[model samples]
Target: MKNKNLSYKFYVIMSLSIAAIPVVFIVLSYAMFFTHLGITSLFNIDNHFSGSVLTTYFYIVFFGILFGLMFIAAKYFKKIIHRINTMEQTVRKIAEDDAFPEKLAVIEESEDELNKLAASINTMIDRLRAKEMELSQMEDLKREYLKQLSHDINTPLNALNLELYLYSQNHNVSKEEVDVLYQKVDYISKLVNSISSEALFDIDNYYIFKEDISVHKSLKQTINKWSYLLNKNNIEYTIDVQKNLIWQANELWLDRLFENIISNIFKHSATNQIVITVGDTLIIKDYGVGFEIDRDHETTGLSVIKNICQKLNIQLDIESTNAGTAYRLSQE
Candidate 1:
C-alpha cells in the first residue's frame, strides 16, 4: 500500500550523482601522486614526462567517468518519467468514472504521498453514498403522503356532488331531505378544511393547538356532528366510549379525523350496525360491506386515519374483510 512519488525519487538520485564528482576527483589525485612522486621518482622519471603522462591519463579517466555517470542518470530519469506518465493516465481514468488502482506502485525503500490522497477520496465517496440513501427515503415518504391526501379529499367531494345533484332534480323534495343534503355538504366542507390545514401544518411546521382534552368527548361530538347523515342513511350505530378518557391533543383536528372516517362508512359501506368504543384505546367497527384485502379502497377515510395517527402520535391499525371494517387507535 505504500505510494511513491516518481519525481521525488528522481530528484534524490540526481543529488547522489552530483555529490560523487568530488569523490571521483579525490581518487584520481591519489593515484597520480603515488605513481609519479612517491614510487616512480625512484626510477628517475623526469617532471616533464611524468606530468605529460599524468595529464593524458587524467583526461581519459575524466571523460570515461563523465560519460558513464551521464548514461546511468539518463536511464534512471527515463524510468521515473515513464512511471509519472502512467500515474497521470490513471488519474484521468478515475476522473472519467473508471475504478482506481487498488494499490499505488512504489519502490520498496521510497516514501509515497499518493496513498493518503486515495484514502481521502474513498472516504468522501462513502459519505456521498450515505447521503444519497437518506434523500431517497425522504422522497418515498413524500410520494406516499401525497397519494393518500389525493384519495381522501376526492372521495368525499365526489359523494357530496352526487347528493347535491340529486337534491336539485327533486322539485317536490321534503324538508327532511333538504336538511340531509345540507348536512352532507357541511361534512364535505369540513373534510376539505381539515385536509388544507393538515397540509399547511406540515409545510409551516405549525400545528393548530396544544391542549389537555378529553378524547371521549371529542369522539362523541364528532359522531354527533354526523348524526344527520347516519340517520338519513338508516345506519345503526352505537357508542360505548367511557366518560373520562383524556389526552393531550388538538380537539378540532381530532374531531375532523373521526368525522372523515365515519362519513366514509356512510358513503361507501353498505351495512347497518356500527359500533364505536372508547377507553384507553379508541376503536371503531362497522358491520358493513367489508373491504377486500387485495383491493385498494377509494374512500378518503383511510388517508384521514393515517393522518390522525401521525399527528396524534398514536398507533392506528385497520382490519377489514367481507364481514366488516374495524379501526383501532391506541396511544403508545
Candidate 2:
C-alpha cells in the first residue's frame, strides 16, 4: 500500500541546509575581521574601528539578513509540514470513521501536488467504501440463505423422524431396526445442529477446533456400541486394542465414523466374523463376501467416511478383495 504521509527526509534535509547558510556567512565575517586587523597595522592605526557606526551597521545588516533568512525558511516549510500532518490525520479518519476529509480540509481544488494527492486518497476511500458495502450485502444474503435452507430441509426431516418414532411402536417392527432408525434420526439431528451452532455459514469468524478426546476411550465406546448392534445379528467379532492413547477429536464424530463403517458392514456383508485393532491406526477387517465399490452410488458409506476423516485430519485407506474387506483410519 502507498503510504499516506509525505516523506519527512526531504523537509529534514532542507531545514539542515537552511541552518548551515548562517554558519558559512559567520565564518566569512570572522575572516574579514582578521583582514581588517592586518590593514590597521599596515596603516599604523592606533585605535581599531570596532566601535565605529559603519562597523556596527555592517554587523547589524549581516545579523539582520541572517534572521530574515531564518524567518523565510520557517514560513516556507510550515504549510508543507501542516499538509503532511493533515494527510496523516485524514488517513486515520478514513480508517476509523470511514469518512473522507471535509471539503475545506482537503488541500484544495487547484491542481497542486498536494491537491492531486488528496484527490487520489479520496478516490481510494470511495472504492473502499463501495467494496465494504458490497461485502456486507453478500454476507447478509449468505446468512439468509443458510437460515431458510436449514429450515426447509430440517422441517421435513423433523416430521419424518416423528413418524418413524411412532411407527416403531408396532409389534411387527424389530427393536434392533427401530434402534437403527433412532440412530439415523439422531445423526441427522446432530448434523443440522452442528451446522447451526458452529456458525458454519459465517465465514468471517475465525474457527477454533476443540478435540479434547481420549482416543482410546472414545473409540472403545464406539466399538462397543456397534458390537451390541452386530451381536444381535449373531455375527461374531474380536478386538485388539492399545491403551492410553488420546488426541483432539469430537467423541460423537468418532462414534459416527465407526457407526457408519460398521453399519455398512452389517447391511452388505454376510460375514460371520470380523476383527478390529486399535493402536497407531484403527483397522477393521471383515471376511465377508466383498462387493465392488460402485462409484455411481452415493448410498455407499465411503463418501461420508472420506469427509469425516478429512475433517479430523485422519488418513483413510481401503482394501477389498474376493476373500475380505479391510479399512484403515490413522493420523498423519
C-alpha RMSD of each candidate structure in angstroms: 12.8, 8.6
Clashing pairs in 1: 3-112, 152-300
Can you write out model 2's per-residue Cα lDDT over 72-181, one digit (the tens) per residue? 76876797778778877878887788555553245444545676777777777778878989988987786787778778878888898778777876556777666666
Q: Cα miss at 171, model 2 (Å)?
A: 6.8
The TM-score leader among the candidates is 2
TM-score of each: 0.45, 0.56
Candidate 2 to truth, TM:
0.56
* Candidate no. 1 TM-score: 0.45
The local distance difference test score of each candidate is 0.69, 0.71
Best by lDDT: 2
